[model samples]
Target: MCVMSRRGRFQRGEGRHLCNLSGPPSGGSASPGSFLPLRGIDLKKGGRVKKPGRKALVSKDPYLRLLVKTYKTLARRTSSAFNRTVLKRLLMPRRFKAPISLSKLIKHMKGRENTTAVVVGTVTGTLLYRDMMMYVSTESRRSSDSAGEDDLRVNEVPKLSVCALRITRTAQARLLKAGGEVLTFDELVARSPTGSKCTLLRGATKAREAEKHFGKAPGTPGSSTKPYVRSKGRKFEKARGRRKSCGFKV
Candidate 1:
């Protein structure tokens, strides 16, 4: 027998019986019924499952791995934001670590002359002008072979000390030749424990030619996006929908 409760549902009662707390009262005890309501614990609410890690790192280069380990230690020990940033960048792929040229470095380091320039990628060589005891002469208008090494100029290019993951052969030579220093990651750690007096520089990311074709439809008005075409010939994409005579403008 079952008894109804005030809610009109039959809840489980004493042994071998069911109780409908909302309905009329029933017999005291009844045979054990096969049907039993599922317990509350059986139903699982929807939720987000915990994952192992935030994101997996994708890198296998031994040198990069070493740098990551070094910076990771520094990041945890000193609690410096610069070290943390460097560690994060070290774990990133090669694309994010773009190579910087010597010319750009020179331009950026103009005002911050004393501070060390740090690049997470390779550094390419650029021409450096320095003041030396070299002779210079201009050819005479009267004679073609009248020029000789005579005058000297004191114009000198400033020396730049930099730290980077990699430096080109020519760049290293030029830096060393100009009384500049090129230090590695480990060396940088030893020099500046907390990355003080350091300026981080990144390559021009949007300077790549491929970025020009990344926005808006190519043929749309006021859109400057470049279209994918084989060549710039007049007959290539200049027909039909592209011209009003053949069809409507696209």
Candidate 2:
């Protein structure tokens, strides 16, 4: 028969549900009851069946119960540790989720390369630029009294056309509003007018200055001279300082 106590429900982390007392009161000589409130701990209809690591005692104190749980967890981890078999398993992390598959991507790429005969192809067509440099590789064959004199020849790689990347007007406006000043030549091509964009080499060195032309001067423009007779009030104040008013001070 299940026998639960009235005084059980130790605050969590207290005794790890370990009671200082033993099983049901019926298991003992007396009636199954306790010194505490009769709510919360439901006996298995009759009472809660005693499960593994079931409640043993109850207390409100925190530090005392924390002590018991820490020791148990420490002991479990330290036991049977540091052997070769255990070490290998511990070093490798156990994963629960499968990784994303890239094989399909590789297959698609291979199919594309076969069709185009190039490793990679871009959707945007290529663009050409002027003033770009090409290096000439000069190779000389030094014949040590042998296969005649093979003269030096210059070999150059094919002239590569550089594509200028562009930024949208909305993007440029947003960037400018965000206080972004620096932009590459390609970036300027996207947002700026052709002339302005071409002028900038690599990054934005020149910021467009705000215009200062105005229709009118800020403050009073017509007279530009001080108004007269303002000192009359000061003279009146001086005259009143000596004169007496008809009041109770008399």
Candidate 3:
């Protein structure tokens, strides 16, 4: 038998065979002159990148989901830019499509005869204008007798077709009473897929009081932004911003 060390070799019939090592083989590190190996992560641009949120809606309401699904299909099938716009608005947050008042609708839809007014959000009632009061008086006898006089001069409210996500009870009843129609968004989609003969309207986004305080600082020169103060008085923010005597007038 031949003496064996780290490697055990035996000669049998003029052929030499080596014994296999029990543990793992070692001592195969790269030399100093050899190129360094690159890691998987380092080979790629792996940092987080900023991007816009998903455009599609994830509403829990079944009806809204159904509407979104329908609109998505329609938007994919049809090339109408109007449908595309409606889909985008439908996916937007409720604040973006704030509720619109009937008075605003009347004002905007003026002279657009036989056209459907579409609102993506709720449709609310307005303080009855003199003209609308007359229309409301005839249909709703609950009004005071002074409102219903045959000989009295009154303005006539124009008949209109309104489409909205929701309509307040008062606005709905008034519209129906005035021979005007109240339509759901689905109905509008069915009636005018391409938004033909329709006038799309949105609420005044800047009308909110909170929006007043959103510009430059209250005391900044030439800045008309509103400030959030407890009260408006001489002791309040009226010193530096209001008069040149205190420090400097804005």
Q: In terms of lDDT, which candidate is strongest? A: 3
How far residue 243's Cα lies from its native spot in candidate 2, in Å, is 99
User: How well is each residue in 2-104 modelled by candidate 1, as lDDT tens digits?
Assistant: 4444587655443333432233337545444434442222224564456642132568778877887788788888879999888877776777778888877
Candidate 1 residue 5 Cα shift, in angstroms, is: 21
Which scores greater on TM-score, model 2 or model 3? Answer: 3
Better of 1 and 3 by lDDT: 3
Q: Rate the local accuracy (lDDT) of all candidates.
A: 0.73, 0.28, 0.73
Cα-lDDT of candidate 3: 0.73
- For candidate 2, what's the RMSD? 29.7
Ranking by TM-score: 3, 1, 2
Candidate with better TM-score, 1 vs 2: 1
- Candidate that would win on TM-score: 3
| Model 1, residue 156: C-alpha shift (Å) | 5.4
TM-score of each: 0.65, 0.12, 0.69
Weakest lDDT window of 10 consecutive positions for candidate 3:
35-44
lDDT of 2 by residue, 1-250 (tens): 2223447543422222233344446655644364333223433345555654323214344542442343233335555221222222222222211121122222233323222111110112112122332432333234522556322231111211111123345333332443433243233224432222122112111221221222333223342222333465645433322335622121
